[model samples]
Target: MGRRRSAVLTVLIALVAIYSLVPLAWLVVNATKTQEGLLSSFGLWFDDGRFALFDNVRQTLTYDDGVFVRWLGNTLLYVVAGAGGATLLATLGGYGLAKFDFPGKRAVFAVVIGAVAVPGTALAVPTFLMFSRMGLTNTPWSVIIPSLVSPFGLYLMWTFSQQAVPDEMLEAARIDGAGEFHTFFRVSAPLLGPGIVTVLLFTVVATWNNYFLPLIMLKDPQWYPLTIGLNSWNDQAQTVGGQAVFNLVITGSLLTILPLLAAFLLLQRYWQSGLAAGSVKE
Candidate 1:
């Protein structure tokens, strides 16, 4: 009975793996095919005599005067600026909330927790109007500024600080004549490394994948990030004259996913450390 149960479990796991990977496999296979092959061949199977992976890449870069590269640059900018700022704010705010006590601290924390519960999508219209009033709409700052205030990232950091950082160590640092800011920067920051990286990774992915904010804020196609750019390509591809763009859109999407995959592989160690740190006894 034990052997039979094990065999069934193994088969079920294998089936689940296949189910998850099949779409990704189809995307990879289709990305290598030319427009004609993409249209003519089975999506999951390779086409005969038509491997245009390089051609697709070249055309993807060359399309509409190489606008895709500009979009890539914009994406990198937004991700770095928004994620980096959000990570810093989350770390500082969370650390303060977790360690320090002051007037209205409970109220502040309550607001942070409430903010986390509020759906970001629900705030889009309000944010848009606020930016519009400031004459900041239709610019990169419109998308970036909103991305910087990640309530979930702040909540994650607060939870991490509570679990990962000890009050005793902070007290020791204070006793050793380290100013609060100095101690936080020199001591607690280093200790919070895993949490910081985890928060940064999460914020980066969130900003990178954000579509609706940019869609509502940005009016110029030149300011579009990969998400909006790929969407524009998709829209254009529906027309007869833009049929060839389908291959480029798919190829660009494949390219867009690589940076995120690389980031995960590189920072996965910190994520593991973060999970472990949260569980470690002081």
Candidate 2:
């Protein structure tokens, strides 16, 4: 009976894995085809005698005077500044909330919780109006400023800090005459490695994949991120008499996901550790 059940579970797991990986496999297979090959060949299989992955990549990078490269740079800028800033602020805010006592602390906690519950889509229009009034719309500041606030990241760090850090160690540092900043940096920071990486990965992925906010905020193609830029290419095919660069779009998408895949691969350990935190008593 046990063996039968185990085999059934293994089959289910294999099915789930295939379900998740099939789209990625399709994307990989199609990215290697040319414009003509893509329309002519099967999506899940490579085109015979016409592997144009490098050619598609070259055209993707050089198309429209290298707009794809510009969009890539813009994405990097948003991730570094917007996501990086969000992680830093979340780390500090969460640490303070977890470690310190202050007036209105309960109120702050309530606000953070409320913010986390609110969906970003609900705030998009209001944020757009606010930025428009400030003359910040259509500029990178609009996107960067909004991206800096990650309620979920703050909450994750807050929860992680409470368990990962001990009050006794902080007291010992204080008794040894270490200032708050010094103690946090030297003591608490080390213990927060996994949590920090987790939050960073969250923020980076959020900013990298952000579409709605940037869509409503930016109008200039020069300032567009890869998501919007790739979307524009896709939309071109939908328009009447518009030039379709579906091959470039497919190749660009593959390129777009490579960095994120690399990030997850490199930070897998830290992210797993972060998730497992507080699962066991110390």
Candidate 3:
């Protein structure tokens, strides 16, 4: 009975893996094809006799005065600022909530939980209006500011800190004449590594992939991130007399995802440990 159940579970897991990987497989295969070949060949198979991967990449980078490169830079900027800021804020906020006791703590928890329940799309319009009043619309700050608040990241850090950081350790640090900042930097911060990396990965992915907010906030093509820029390239195919650069778009997309993949591959160990940290308690 156990062997039969194990086989069934293995098959199910394999199916799920295949299902998730098919699109990525399709993207990889199609990225190698030329515009004509992409239209003519089977999507899952490589185009025969005309491998355009290098050419497509060159064109993607050099296209329209190297706008794609600019967009990539903009995306990196957003990720570094918005995502980095969000991770730092979430860590500090989470650590505080986990360790410190203060007035209205329950209220603060409720507010954070409520914020987490609110979808970002629901807040977009209101945020746009507020930014417009502040004359921050069409600027990078509009996107950066909004991306800094990660309620989910904060909550995850809070839970992780509760388990990962011990009150007794903090008391010991305090007893040793260590200041709050010194203790946090010297003792608790080291212990929070996995949680920090977890939050960083989440925030980086969020900021890097953010589209709707930047779409609504920014007007300048120079400030457009890869998401919106690639979207614009994709949209070009829809307009009358528009040049169809689908090959560049596909190549650009492949380029865009490489960083995220690298990030996951590099920090997945920390991310996994961070997720499992609070689940088991002694």
Candidate 4:
């Protein structure tokens, strides 16, 4: 009976893997085709004598006078600045909440929980109007500023800090003439390494994939990130007098995942450690 249960679990895992992998595999296969081939051929497998992966990539990069590269740069900028800011704020805010008791602490938590409960999309319209009134619309700040505030990240850091850092160590630091900031930076910060990396990765992915905020905020193509840019290419493919870039879109989509996949692979160890550390307090 145990053997049968084990076999059933193995089969379920395999099925889940296949289900998740199939679409990704299809994207890879289709990315090798041309615009004509993409529409004409079977999506799951590359058709005979229709390989155009290099050309598709070449066109995807060079299209619109290399606008894709600009989009990539913009994405990198947003991810770095926005994610970095969010991580810093979350870490500091979380550390404080975890270590210190202050007035309205419960109220502050109530607000944080409420922010987490609210979908960012639901607030996008109002946020856009507010930014516009503040003369920040169509600028990078319009996106970067909003991305810096991550309620979930703050909560994650607060919980992680509570477990990863000890009050005794903080007291010792105070006795050693270390200021609060010094103690946090020199001692508490090191212990929160995994948590920091975890928050960094989460914010990076969130900022990198942010679409709706940038979409509704900026009108200029120059400020567009990869998500909006590739989407524009897709829309162009569907419109009259627009460039036929369906294949470029597919190849671009494929390219987009590579950085994220690499990021996860490179940080997988830290991510797992962070998650484990968070789950098991002290």
Candidate 2 residues 119-189, lDDT tens each? 99999999999999999999999889999999999999999999899999999999999999999999999
Point out the higher-scoring one by lDDT: 1 or 4.
4
Top candidate by TM-score: 3
Clashing residue pairs, backbone N/CA/C < 3 A, model 1:
none
Q: How big is the RMSD of model 3?
A: 2.4
State the lDDT of candidate 4 residue by residue for 1-282, as single tens digits: 999999999999999999999989998999888777776778898966668999989998998899999999999999989999999999999999999999999999999999999998999999999999999999999999999999999999999999889899899999999999899889898789888888888999999899999999989999999999999988988888564778888899999989999988888887777667657664
- Model 1, 59-154: lDDT tens digits are 999988999999999999999899899999999988888888789988888898899899889999999999999999999999989988988888
Q: Residue 224 of model 2: what lDDT?
A: 99
Q: List the pairs of residues colliding in candidate 2.
A: none
Q: Runs in model 2 with CA error above 4 Å?
A: 1-9, 240-244, 270-282
TM-scores of all candidate predictions against the true structure = 0.92, 0.93, 0.94, 0.93
Error of 1 at 185 (Å): 2.1
TM-score of structure candidate 4 = 0.93
Alpha carbon lDDT at 26, candidate 3: 86
> Mind giving the per-residue lDDT tens digits that candidate 3 earns over 1-282?
999999999999999999999988988888899989988899999988699999999999999999999999999999999999999999999999999999999999999999999999999999999999999999999999999999999999999899899999999999999999999999998789888998999899999999899999999999999999999999996677554598888889999999999999989977677557645635
Kindly report which residue stretches of model 3 are placed more than 4 angstroms away from their true locations once superposed: 240-243, 269-282
TM-score of 3: 0.94
Candidate 3: give the clashing pairs.
none
Error of 2 at 87 (Å): 0.6
